[model samples]
Target: MSDAAAPGQPVLADLTTIGVGGPAVRLVEPTTGDELLAAARDAFTSDEPWFVLGGGSNLVVADDGFDGTVIRVATRGIEVLSETDDGVRIRVAAGHPWDDLVAETVARGWSGIEALSGIPGSVGASPVQNIGAYGQEVSATVVSADFLDADTLEFVRVPRANMGLAYRTSVFKAGQSHPARPGVITAVEFELHNGGGVSEPVAYAQLASALGVALGDRVPVADVRDRVLALRASKGMVLDPADADTRSCGSFFTNPIVSPEALEGVPADAPRWESSPEAQDVAVPLGELPAPPPPPAPAAVKLSAAWLIEHSGIPRGFSLPGSRAAISSKHTLAITNRGGATAAEVTELARFVQSRVASEFGVLLHPEPILLGAFL
Candidate 1:
């Protein structure tokens, strides 16, 4: 465990993808899982407020910065736990780079995560957000994770069935319920298919169009990754040091999930999808009569935040006059720092966008990024 005090100033602005935020009072970087667990334990036992920092892609720190201890895990390893004829079960250290893991899996013909190519963040943070893209969600492949339970201060293994994973959120996230236990993830296990050099069938329409293939076509695994990266780069979703537009926490707002009736206020042509299909499959025992079906469950609707923002008159590349914070020129879903933008500016712009969408469509937009010492 590297308990050595950080030298000089340690500003979060230098660590995060977005060029904002102030300095941390103390920063600890653990190079191994044991060290990470140790650091987490120490933080938990102390009274100081602390947080685990991952890739810093889905976080926004206030200009005043976090006055608490910050634990940054640097543990690294990818182990093949088990292998069978059709699939491979592997475990990854929480600190492993997520895209690198995807690349490695695709190169080895593992098909489950091919569509999640260019997402930025660490493996540890993946399940917390149930990260997804191009119709491939991490929840679909995650098998289990090892963690240092915050409540008990003990290490435990949690299975996927208890994760409470849903669109863009999990029990590990704040304001969420932990079916198993809330803790700091130390490692994650995934079950990946041996695709024989092909990818999962195309599930997202945009991805299918980019690959010049119809939905359900299984392109080469490498090709899917290449196209996914290209798509992300085009939208400024991929991180790039030279692209100012890429200097942001990818999507500022999560698509608003609303009851079907609540969507009546939205435009008829607005892009919306059913969050979950009503369950219909049923079974009857041999020689036993089938029972009548119960009432169908109501399906929730997910409205596109980008479409709502655009329709509410907030266009891409928009910014408050004389303010450095602005909406990404490539994607309205992101609020960007033009350079030297403050947390106040970012929140101001976020609030403005939210107010506009709410007034126009009667729908409230919630931020996808975790705001530390800031609110929207």
Candidate 2:
């Protein structure tokens, strides 16, 4: 582990997708699990604050930068611990690129994650964020995650049930507010199906339409992966150095799960979805669409944040006059860095968007990225 800063050392901006943050006071990149644990232990033991950076896809750091140690999880490996007729259980190192695992799984006929293609980040960030897209979430297949508990400085394995998996969050991401042990994840295990190379049934409507199939249809895993990648790329969700729209956190805000009463003023045409995992997984009847449900008291409904933002008069690509930060041109959910934008500019734009949505819809949107030394 090296903590010395050099004249041309990389800054947090250079490491992050949005390219906005300042430099790390001390940077630690561990390429092995043992090194990662040691580095984490040292950081935790130190008086200085610290953060574990993954693939850097879902972070927004302040322009002033992190004042303490920043440990980058860079370990890599994929190990199959067991296999059966039904499925295969594999353990992945925390630093492994997330999409690389998805691609590998699809190529090997492992069907669980085919629908989650094109998401950027490290495998370790999966359970932490409970990352989901196109109707697939890591919680559905994750068996366990190994961690080096900071409080005790002992390594432990946490089962899926103990992770507190929820929409876009888990115990790992909850920080001090949660009762669960806090630590840095070292690896994750997942059980993926071997369904004769076929993917799980398509549960999301858009994905089904893209594949020219009805909901509940099963297609080749490779095909599912290909289409998902294409869809994400078109929306600027995929990482591309040439695409300025991709220079931001994948999504700036989480889809708010709110009381039905919060939707009182939202337009009847606004999109809504059931917030429960089971409900979200069920496919709608082919060729039939249900009318929007009226706001029902006590039932949680997930609203489309994009719809709210757009309806609030914030169009895609909207930017404050002369500001370097702007909404993504391809998708309204992201706030992009036009060029050399600072974290302050990004947060300013974010606050503007939040105010508009809250004023127009009476519902507040929460940021999806892990902000370091940054506030909304």
Candidate 3:
């Protein structure tokens, strides 16, 4: 329940993990339910361009700074509503860090979101983008996400089915943020597995193979989390400020799921699966060729966006002359800040990659993070 910045107080850069962006116009941290609700409704009534800023991880703010009020959802809580052999019902505050909730659930031997172990950002934002990692997305287990219906100015806890969780997007993430159209997510509720200590059947082939086990194997929940974290750490997906690769917002683009026709357009050796050059080639060749002479890339395949970027001739760390920002040297999907780069500069580099990928692969790559002030 703190007041907005008084005067000299600096903005998000001091607190955000990204280490960039200009000062926020106004930053409000609402610790109580009434405060959060009042601030949201007030901004709505006044026609203020308000955004519910959370974890600040999966966001890229512009250089000019947000020119409107920013409601920082600092409201926090995590409670076990029920426990049983079938499932566990629990509710989490929107402001809670996503990984913290995952860890807590895993620690208590819960088996729903363990595979989303290393993802960054807030619980509220999870439903917004359907935060995903390894083989698990928050959408798979979310029973409901509670939000203040900005339109009606009332509490509405929409069911998971109504949230519209796609590969890595949702209604909240897909809509515009104007007075006429804004989705202010407040909290989320999940129903996790309490069926003994067994995990959900492993879905990702890479994950199953890494555990030296076959697909559909149900290993210990803890082991799955441990293995997933190790893999993400290697790719700098898990946060590490010292390493520039980690200085990125995880994977920049989602793995493209192309139509059957789109699949046929792609070549046989095209880096198809995510995670590697050879692995993609291997995944396709392992099974019998799909019918229809192999359309673009089937909805059957998850094309590696990083491979597309590299093959597009924009190698990691490749930047135009005299630019501080560039692609990450460790991975191509991540566009990095090589120190002293402004938000606009980052935006420019991002556009360049998208343009190049379009020209090269004929696939338009979309940004995965929340971009403010300008489109990514």
Candidate 4:
């Protein structure tokens, strides 16, 4: 329904929070579920490359631009499927803004996602990345999702168990390749409890400290949401048109999870957390138990990418030669578009950072954003 040169038309730069990338050849904004399905099917059947866009917070497209159709999901709806003494189950449209839904649920005393406040992107994108912050990930609350599998040309209800949700990836993220032939998420369902103004046990240390509570203590949900928003704003994680630091794909790299042997030669004070065991062990049916466990494997460790970058000598606000794109002034983890930046510039900066980190620590940092025609 839209072209790149139409009056007030949107380019990738306008659509993305990073404010970079070239225009799409054609863009379709579908406002209904049926329309979304039809648009996806049309693009798939035509055998042309296509991309699905949500809030456009986690993308970096190439300067040459996409030559295929782009489907912008704009559909919106939320319905409570049922409520019980234990909790409530609700279904949300894929196009819904993630933070808005968090705010709404928090306002109504929902306990599952208060820690996810101020995250950018859409509800549908959450499961793809297993979006998490302050120690709470979408994988914890997701019950199921209604996905249109373009490969099979059928709608399938994928339960959380089948989603392959991990630290920050799922089957959906794996299917990002062949975009026109990938499964299209239509809606997601969540189960949240009525916590009576209280929150789930505080998990992240920074959040606990912000609320003046000890780790593992529960606080008021409203307090948690407010403090989370304030904390995110401080790091420029929340969107603000005037703040150059906020003009980024949030957290450009994921924390690297490595085997115990990979931690050699790193500084003693480097931030690291123990990685959880693989899901298969915990996901087995309740009554079915595996035989006696084999000897324990070396514990996997998750290292902080921000710590690695700073220690590797790349400081905040660092930029490549003659490029407007730079590391966020507020946080070492973000690569920001400091106005008039191009996708190539962003890519250049990212690659430079990765090289520095790898050279200093022997670990290559991988980008967290979805790259379209752009590579590090």
Candidate 5:
């Protein structure tokens, strides 16, 4: 990060998969744990807007730009804290690349996060959204997270119960509404099964079919990780700069859940599924699905976000306002900056998609990325 501006280095264009955003006021990269702590502490007291920049994957900053300190979490450390015949415990620094960690864990014969392979971001951000894919969420394997309390500046440990994990939310996300803590994620601890794949079953159908295994079937950890990466790459969910479809912050919207009454009204053609076991409600079509030939159109149940966007008339490559930002032609869910678009241009695209989908399907789309300057 020291050579941040050594000529021909359009930092944002190269760093983020989306290829947008302005230059940082000052970029802080701490290579060690102590350094990270010190940087956070200094930012805590400095009269400047501080953002704990992680992987810089899941972000949409304004072109007008952030007029504050950008503390990039660059600390690097990973270790097997302890192990047993049944399980292995691991510790990963927040700054570690999430997908790389998954690959390493699978390579070592540990299961649990294999299904989350290829997801772009820092290890710390995984807990923020409980990042999930192929039917497995990081929350399932996370034993606890060691974080720096944004307010008190003391290192605090948030266990599973206190983590407030849910559909794309956690204690820090929901709790932040009440008040802001230093909210800096420092490290994550995971207890993974050592026997075969993982204790948590594979729930996404695409993954099962891709691996030629049944839903809930356990496969080799490496195989699961590989298949998950392939599946993600197919949908542009994986970060691949060469592919326009991947010029996005992964999925743009969370799959919308509906109440039982709402489900009753959806067209019979939509996928209908449920979120939990005890809940007496069914999930119906909410959006579009990526082009994966074998999955039988996802049933008329839990509607795929990609499908909803397409059906809503927002096809890939859709754009507006004479801007380069466009929805990737390969996947409707991802809106790309097309090499030179600004945050404002992307927001315009997002707003247009949101309006179109909500009007057509009556389902409001919430952006997956955390917006710093604007909201729809």
Candidate 6:
């Protein structure tokens, strides 16, 4: 194990983005996969609680802190494994900053992940959440991941198909019920097209509007990155130390998906989108003849959590009495720490938001971040 894993470790407040967690009993920074495996073994065999930390961008730890080992994956490397006619295949270590890799791929004119620019956290955490934005999810391009299976205590390579990747979760994120199946992602491989200078077709409407192009039009990859960065900064999604609004977990809640029956009491004007049965009741393009309808199918609808919060009388920047945490002034979806907020304060604000939305709309907003010794 690395020397940092010794006693008298730094507080988790210095490790996470929101800056609110308490001290860890022991902190280990593993610079190699073997070192990481050894550290995990030592902690597990000793019957001590342990947690793996990545960029710490998407976690909220309790103020009382954890009384166990904290392994910080600090291994670093990026290797080009192959360049086929279809695309380039590369493996990135878990410690590599996610946005830096996106920038590198864009600079090299790779097409698949150009739209994922400016997201925080590490590559290993991406598959855990199946991270996505502006219509592109990391699951789309992942070839496989190398992980240490806690069950066997051995290294294994799992293909993307077996990862159980869904909207914002995977099998790696199993809860307490799967105690014997804990796994730590070591690295991820991706397949990206050599698009020369172009990017994948613009798939999100807001992004297309920002670039002054129609949906599905491919623009320069560099331009896509710049536009995405500008858009994220506008909403305080980009990380900036001087910006208080950026001191958040990006979007605090995932867009809630509901069945059609659940929408009966919802307002007609509420912002929603079709999540399943893609062509269900959708209008055809002008001047195009409508094709024969397929058999009726069930549809899943996605509702905007921000809209629910705002309509439930919780505006942007809303905070409870004397709480140091407040919703982001730029976006209702984010809860930010004004300064010196505690984990309890953040949890209180989140619970308040969830209660208000649920009471008003019968929809409970679930937190997107992985809560550590904290809940909403």
lDDT winner:
2
Positional deviation of residue 369's Cα in model 6 after best superposition, in angstroms: 0.4
What lDDT score belongs to each candidate, Candidate 1 first? 0.84, 0.85, 0.73, 0.83, 0.72, 0.82
Using TM-score as the yardstick, the better of models 2 and 5 is 2
Residue-pair clashes per prediction, in order, are 0, 0, 11, 0, 21, 1
- Superposed model 1: Cα runs more than 4 Å off: 1-7, 177-181, 277-297, 374-376
TM-score of 6: 0.90
For 1-376, candidate 2 gives per-residue lDDT tens digits of 1222356655888889998887778899999988999999999898998899999999988777777889999999999998887899999999999999999998889999998899999999999999999989989999999998888888999999989888887889843134545679999999999887999999999999999999999999999999999999998999999999999998998887766656687788899976652112111121123233333344677889899999999999999999999999999999999998988888889888888888887776777887776341
Root-mean-square deviation of candidate 2: 7.1
Backbone clash total for model 1 is 0
lDDT of 6 by residue, 247-302 (tens): 98888887876767667667999999988542222222211233554544577788
Error of 4 at 31 (Å): 0.9
Question: In model 4, which regions exceed 4 Å deviation?
Answer: 1-10, 175-181, 277-297, 374-376
Q: Model 1's lDDT to the true fold?
A: 0.84
Tens digits of per-residue lDDT, candidate 3, 217-244, equal 8988889889998888877777887886
lDDT of 5 by residue, 22-138 (tens): 555566788788888888888887887777778878777666445566778887778888988888999999999998898888877888888788989899889888888778888
Off by over 4 Å in 5: 1-14, 174-180, 196-200, 263-265, 276-302, 374-376
In terms of TM-score, how similar is model 5 to the real structure?
0.86
TM-score of each: 0.91, 0.91, 0.86, 0.91, 0.86, 0.90
Error of 2 at 93 (Å): 0.3
What shift in Å separates residue 114 of candidate 2 from its native position after superposition?
Answer: 0.8
Kindly list the per-residue Cα lDDT of model 4 for residues 136-247, writing each as its tens digit: 9999999999998877878889999988887787878842221222768989999998878789999999999999999999999999999999999999999999899999
* Residue pairs in collision within model 6: 5-27
RMSD of candidates 1 onward, in order? 8.5, 7.1, 7.5, 6.7, 6.9, 8.2
Off by over 4 Å in 3: 1-9, 175-181, 271-301, 374-376
